[model samples]
Target chain A: MRIIRYSEAINEALHQLLASNKKVFLIGQGVTSPWYVGTTTVGLIDRFGPHRVFDTPVSENAVTGLGVGAALTGMRPIVVHPRMDFMYYAMDQIANQAANWHYMFGGQMSVPITIWGIINRGGEQGAQHSQALQAIFAHIPGLKVVMPSTPYDVKGLLVASVEDDNPVIFIDDRWLYNYEGDVPEELYSIKIGKGIVRRKGKDVTIVATSYMVYKAIEAGKDLEKEGVDVEIIDLRTVKPMDKQLLYNSVKKTKRLVIADASWKTCGIGAEISATIAESKLLTTLKAPIIRITLPDAPAPASSVLEQAYYPESKDIVLAVENLLKYSCDNNEKCDY
Target chain B: MYKKKSVNTDIPLKTLREMYLTMLRIRKFEETVASLILKKEIQTPCHLYIGQEAIATGVCTSLRKSDYVFSTHRSHGHYIAKGGDLKKLMAELYCRETGCSYGRGGSMHIADPDIGLPGSSAIVAGTIPLAVGVAYSFFLQKKDNVSVAFFGDGAVGEGVFYESLNLAALKKLPVLFVCENNLFSTHMPISACLANIDIKKTAETFCIPTARVDGNDVQSVYKTAKKMIENARKNKGPAFIECMTYRWYGHVGPNLDIDKGLRSKEELDYWMKRDPIKKLERQMIQQKILTIAKKKVIEEMIKKEIDEAIAFKNKSHSPEKIDIARSVFKEE
Candidate 1:
């Protein structure tokens, strides 16, 4: 195993996908430009040529529909929107066409398109450019949403999305691109709706999505030094969530803190919290669940406003400590 | 305006008869659909194809069975013309499990991929880009097949329509864009909707070959569509045909809209005089290729087919509640 950047892992997955299947082609705006989609699409045009690496015009709706159509015709196409916020232009094709085609037309056809969207935050980008819309896509029934935080998961998830016989929304965060992890050379696919236990503990359970997984781990380490045990779960797929994993973890810890990289109102955290509240594990909770997420407002342009806008590992740490404090106050068996 | 090229005497009488048969089939099918809707037997909101049969019949008659066709909301004619199974389409309108879409999609989303029609979208201009992508796949696979997208003037307002045209011409993909300019987007007239009335000129701006024809005349539509379809198959790039036609019913359902004051009866009568079926029926009669008695026999045969389709629908089962979530994704 070799340590590689998350972006490099994505590049390798594209290379393997193209080589393995002649029908697989990458189409989107600025696919040929290394700067446009970051290093993930580097040297793709040179290696695969312009045909397989189709750099399309700035037509989000049509390009996304083209991916759906190509998939219908038995070709695997990955349509990319460099910015996740701009996918709104293609919501008709994504939500109405690609997502509905399989179910609408019965099982007669399959639209195996991987709609890859990148989440860009910070850098003074205003509300329009900075967004994490995985929750909106996760709400759609026909689509499967995957957000991988680690380099290893990114490569495996991308491979799995391309190979799946359904539309998959692969949302990646640019903030986690520089993170390095050991990745295998051979191509592999991670299951779509499964989650991973990043770190094991006996205290509060922290359920995190995408880049928040890294933040959760950071919070876990800090909590450990402060004499509070913490368990972190990386929710790789947003939709079709690993509810069993979360339920089992919560059943043991009897306390929960959800950290998500989106708005507070009806976000991934809300969904996870509701799931735990509805299940039989609701009886095991010693304290009320806490959600660490961005405030119910748009991302600000100023660096100072952005700091308060985005919830970090410290927010997770605070939520966990508060939960433990409450649990200890209510239950005599609690040890902090 | 391109001169009406005489229907080549060389195109065999059998092919010409088949063209007439397709148009007749569509007209009869839609007439029955309207009656069914009035009787409340068919619940789907069907966009009738009574007055626009020529374009679909003409274009589809020239297409191979393997050539793909993407259609819009008003698409019963396109499906029938493309050799779609009548029973499945009827079942779809009836919302039965035996439907083309397995009772999931109603009249607006009819599809038969087995006959090269992957699907039809209710959204304006939604299927345009899909057709272009299908053509691109054919080009990439070195297949000689061509894809046709049948949409109304309403789709031109959508941004994706031009995007599809740009990509199709840029790649020299094998596709035909058939604009059935029926002069209305729902209730708004095209004259009021479009800034420039020349739809063909828009295609010409993309540097794709363009043609405008009398859509009511099946021969003109068939001839122009044949030339364009052949050019696409030869890999000469995409082509556009603007078929000036009209829908007899209001935007949807069986309403003529005359009593509703949406459109004038005089206007309806004017277009009715140019009825595609009667125009083709007269031409065949004058050419001595068909007789009045023979035409009656053809009508009888079509009526029997429609009856059989209805019988099939009657026997078909409605979707069960247990299978409600099935086919949401491809099952492994």
Candidate 2:
């Protein structure tokens, strides 16, 4: 195992895919520019030549349609969106065309394309430049969304997405780029819709996605010093979520807190909370479910405002402490 | 001004007969669909290719079986011309299990990738960039295959149209953009939409070779499409051909728009006098290629085909309730 940054893991995965398969090619606005896509696309153009690693003009919708079109003709294409916010311009091609092609055609055709959308938040990028809009793509039926947090999962999930015989939305956060983790050099894939327990405990169950997984782990350590045990589950894939795993963890802990780097309403947290509510697990919960997410407003640019706008590990600790306080104050029997 | 090509003594008699047969099939199939819509047999909205048969027949004739053709909401003519199964298309319109799309796609969404017609969509300019992508695939593979995008004049208003053109030109990919300029975008005239109604000139701005032809004249459209498609197959970049035609029916169903006051009767008559099928029939007869008896025999053959397709549609079953969620994702 080699310790590699999250962005390097992604770059290595693309390199292996292109080398292994001649049908795989990369296309987007700034694939050649590291400043736009980070080091994830580094050295791709030099190794594969220009035909395979194509840097396209700034035509988001057309470029996306180009990917879908090539997929129709049996080419595996990876179309990258430098910023997740501007991907809305390609909504018709993504939602109406790529999402519905397989189903509408009665499974006669398979669109084996990967849409790589990088989430850029903070750095005072403002609302348009900074967004984690996985919820929007996750809402569509035919699309499969995966948000890998660690370096290991990032490389594995990307390979799985490219090989899968459907359009997979691979979302990543720029904040997680520099973080390093152990990744196998060999090409392998982690099963989608599977979650892993980052840190195991029995007090409170924390379900975090993508970048928030690290924050949740940080909070878990801080809570450990205060004698509050926290269990963190890294939800690798969001669409076909591992409901069984979540149910078992929540059943053990009897307390649940969902941390996602998106807005609160109709977000991934809401989906998970609603799923638990509908399941038999509703009876297993000891307190109301809490969600740590961005407030219901656009992200601001000011440094002070940015500090308050985004949630951190401290917020998770506070939420867990508040839940424990409510449990002890209201009930005669307190597990904590 | 677009130069009009004269009737060449070069086209084979058999090819002329085949083009005539294709146009008649489209006209008769749409006419049958009009009656079917009135009879409440087809429940989905259909954009009929009534008077615009020549463009599809002419362009498709120039293409090989391996060449890809992406079409628009008005797609029956393109499908039939590209050798899509008539019974399957009819079954799809009726939303039957044995349909081409297994009842999932109606008139607006039809596909047959086996014959290089990957798919068609209702969204204007939806499949334009897709054709360019397919062309790019061929270019990357060093193949001589060409991809054609058949859209209406309304699609020219979309930004992706120019974007696709620019990409095709930038890559020098082999693609043909066929614009069936039928003079109306739904109920509005092209004049109301485009400040500059020159569709070919718009494509020319991308440095692509452009051609304008009379869509009612099958010979003109065929000659132009063949030249452009041949040029594309040589990997000489993309070409655009704007075929001037008109639709007899309304934007969607069977009813003519004349009663709705969307178009004047005088304008409709002017195009009606230039009916592609009638014009081809006249040319074929004057050339002693089609006698009245032969024409009657051909008409009966097409009528029987449409009848058999309708019967197949009536006999097929609807998709089962248990399989409602099937095919949403390709089962691995």
Candidate 3:
């Protein structure tokens, strides 16, 4: 395996797609600028020229719709939203047009477009810039949402999303960009709607998405010294969610804890909790399920409030401990 | 078997008659929809194309089947004028499985890619960039096809309209922006909405060539659209056409809403006197091209066609319960 950073892996995926396919092009507000998109599209224009790499105006709605139109006309377009918060302006094109085209057209047409939104949380970017809105796209039908934690998954998933025949929301977080992991040199595609076990254990199963998976792994390592064998599962793709993988993990461990970098209400964690409750997976639970997510409030600009507004690795560790205590409380068995 | 002639819009007598017949078809189709909605047969928000037939037919005549036209909610005129199937469009409004979108999208979201009518979005100014993107693809692929975006005067106030105009001009993509200036944005007059109602001037700021036409006069609109389309095909960038017309019915439903206090009977009557079909009819008859009896025959034929479409929609079955969640993506 070859070693690569999360940032370069995405660039490699785009490079391979653009080099191999003539119909594949990039469009967004800051695609070619490395500083804006963080080297994801560096030197792409020099190689493929302007026809393939488009640096558009500050019109988010029109730019997104333009990508939709291009996708409908037999071109694969990867649209970048540097800061995902601004993507709210293009919700009409994303939800109404890109997500509804195939369904509205009776399956006769497909919008082969990939919307790559970068999450820029922390650094006191305030409420407008530092927000993880993957849950919003995950809630919409006709959209496949993917969030990769490792370099291998990010590169493979980006290629898979670009090759997919429907609109895919590929969300990446800046916190994980410099993080390095083993990746293969050749191009490949990871299967969507699948999750993998990051660290296997017999006790509580920790399910996480995107950068939260890295947080879960860190929490799991710390908890292991105290005899807490936490199983960590990285949910590579969220929307057509890896339901079977989640079910298998929860059934095996008999306890579940979901950690996410999104808000509490109507977030990915809430959806997963609902899925378990709806599917009667609660019957197999030894204790009540725990979800570690940010409180339902706007992100504060102050550093202290920002820390409280966001969920971190320590929060995952606390949630796992709470689950263990709840299990003991239910049985009145032992002291921690 | 029935393909529109677009090589040269010198517009022969036969093609002119064809355009006239096409306009009459759109008029009869929307009128049938209105009647059905009144009778509770068609259960959807029906936007009638009673007075603005010339705008769609004239602009669409200059486009080939390979050319794309993205439309707005008031879109039956553009869709039918671009040769969208009458039966499929009717079934879509009827919410039948045989509809254009298989009962998924109703009247506002009718789409059929076979004739290059990719979609009609209900949101105003939503599909403008989509049209530009289609042109971008055509330009990149080096295809001699132009994409048309048919929006109303309301969409001119939308930011995407200006953005689309700028990008299409900057890239010199083959796009023709058609604005059906019906003078109202959902009951608000153009005077109330914008400081300057000369919409083409906004496009000219982007250095794209512009044209203002008498929408009721189909011949003038046809000539202007043909030249712009040809210019885009020759890689001369985009063009704008502000067709001065009026929607006879209210903004939402099928009624002359003069009592709403937004428009006056005088304003309505002044535009109604410039009725596009009658204007073309007068020209055709004066040139000894179409007789009164022939006009009656064409009207009867289009009425029969509408009746057949309604019958087909009636006979069509509804989607099953299991099919409700399908087509969220292309089959797997």
| Top-DockQ structure, candidate number | 2
Q: TM-score of predicted model 2?
A: 0.97
TM-score of chain A of each: 0.97, 0.97, 0.97
Please report the TM-score between candidate 1 and the true structure. 0.97
RMSD of each: 2.9, 3.0, 2.8
Q: Which is superior by TM-score, 1 or 3?
A: 1
Cα-based lDDT for every prediction: 0.92, 0.91, 0.89
Q: Give fnat, all candidates.
A: 0.73, 0.76, 0.81
Cα lDDT of model 2 by residue, A2-39, tens digit: 89999999999999999999999999978888777997
lDDT (tens digit, per residue) of candidate 3 on B164-212: 8888888999999999998999989998999888888877899889999
Candidate 2 reaches a DockQ of 0.80
Number of clashing residue pairs, candidate 2 = 0
DockQ of predictions, in order shown: 0.79, 0.80, 0.78
Docking class of 2: medium
Q: DockQ ranking from best to worst?
A: 2, 1, 3
At residue B5, candidate 2 shows an lDDT of 29
